[model samples]
Target: MELKELLDIERQGWDALCASTGASFYGELMTDDAVMILANGMVLDRAGVVESLRDAPPWRAYEIDDPRLVDVGSDSKVLVYTGIAYRDGAEPAFRGIMSSTYVLTKAGWRLACYQQTQISQ
Candidate 1:
């Protein structure tokens, strides 16, 4: 697939995985060395992130808005956007804005790193 197509696929996978609240799908999309910086200031590796989410509350709903894609060439790109995630019985959590960088590898575009910051707006 072309670079843009690959990114689209990745975006779809991301949304689906979030909607499913399934760690396995998230695990599949992450590289072995992927790093995630959570809004709570926790830095987790691939396994750590997946394992933590496994026990977390299910995502009752989610919306990814205004996905902006930046091509870094050679099959690498960065996706920055704002998203809101709502869990059952909890108020909607607005992620404010976040950025996830993906690298195109033989295994397709695996997420390299993700950082999320809570927005007050």
Candidate 2:
């Protein structure tokens, strides 16, 4: 797939995380062996990540900023970006850089790995 298409999938996943909508769609966007590194440095597998998102607490908004393709191979790509998380009646709760890898599989582009590093104010 083209870079724009892959980035669109990435955006969809983030949007679902922020809106708490389309849980199944989010789950389907991930690979079976996907991995995620949280801002706290804890690592999680596909199921863990999906479950966490499904049960995430309400947030007012989320934004993926400055997303760019960092690397790309024949069937995979790495995206680097920063994200801001907003909560109701509060200042932005989290600002972090995120790196995610996506692989083109038979079903389409699926996230294979992700890492988030929190930026302290």
Candidate 3:
């Protein structure tokens, strides 16, 4: 996919998180074997992601910066970016380098993996 398309998809994900629809959005967007390596040191498979997001609070605001796209092969791509998200009543925003990998599938490009590396102030 092109950079714009990839970034749009990423933005959609962030929007979903802000709207408290992440569990459903991610469930549909993720591949069966998808995994998310969270900033909290949890390595979650697709099922785990669905469960966790069910109770996760929505983010109030978010931004993605310095995004770069990498081709893994002919049918796969990865997005790397600096992301910052804030929630109400939180001391600090969630600042991190986020990575998302997508693989082309018959249904469409599906998320194969996602990871968050927390950035320290």
Top lDDT hit:
3
| Runs in model 3 lying further than 4 Å from the true structure | none
RMSD of each: 2.6, 1.8, 1.2
Least well predicted 10-residue stretch by lDDT in candidate 3: 85-94
Give the clash count for model 2.
0
What is the Å distance of residue 119 in model 2 from its true position? 0.7
Model 3, 29-119: lDDT tens per residue? 9999999999999999999999999989999999899999998998899999999999998755789999999998898789999999999
Which tens-of-lDDT digit does each residue in 1-121 have in candidate 1?
Answer: 3545644754565565556655776688888899999888999998997888777656666677887877777777888778777767767855568787888788767888889999874
TM-score of 1: 0.81
For each of the candidates, give the backbone clash count.
0, 0, 0
Task: Please report, in order, the local distance difference test score of every candidate based on alpha carbons.
Answer: 0.74, 0.80, 0.92
Order candidates by lDDT, high to low.
Answer: 3, 2, 1
Q: Which sections of candidate 1 miss by over 4 Å?
A: 1-21
Candidate 1 lowest-lDDT run of ten: 1-10
**Compared with the true structure, what per-residue lDDT tens digits does model 2 show for residues 1-121?**
4668867877777677667863676578778888889988789887787777787766678887887886678888898888888877768888999898989888878889989999975
Candidate 2: Cα lDDT at 41: 76
Give the CA lDDT, 0 to 100, for residue 74 in model 1.
71
State which candidate, 1 or 2, has the greater lDDT.
2
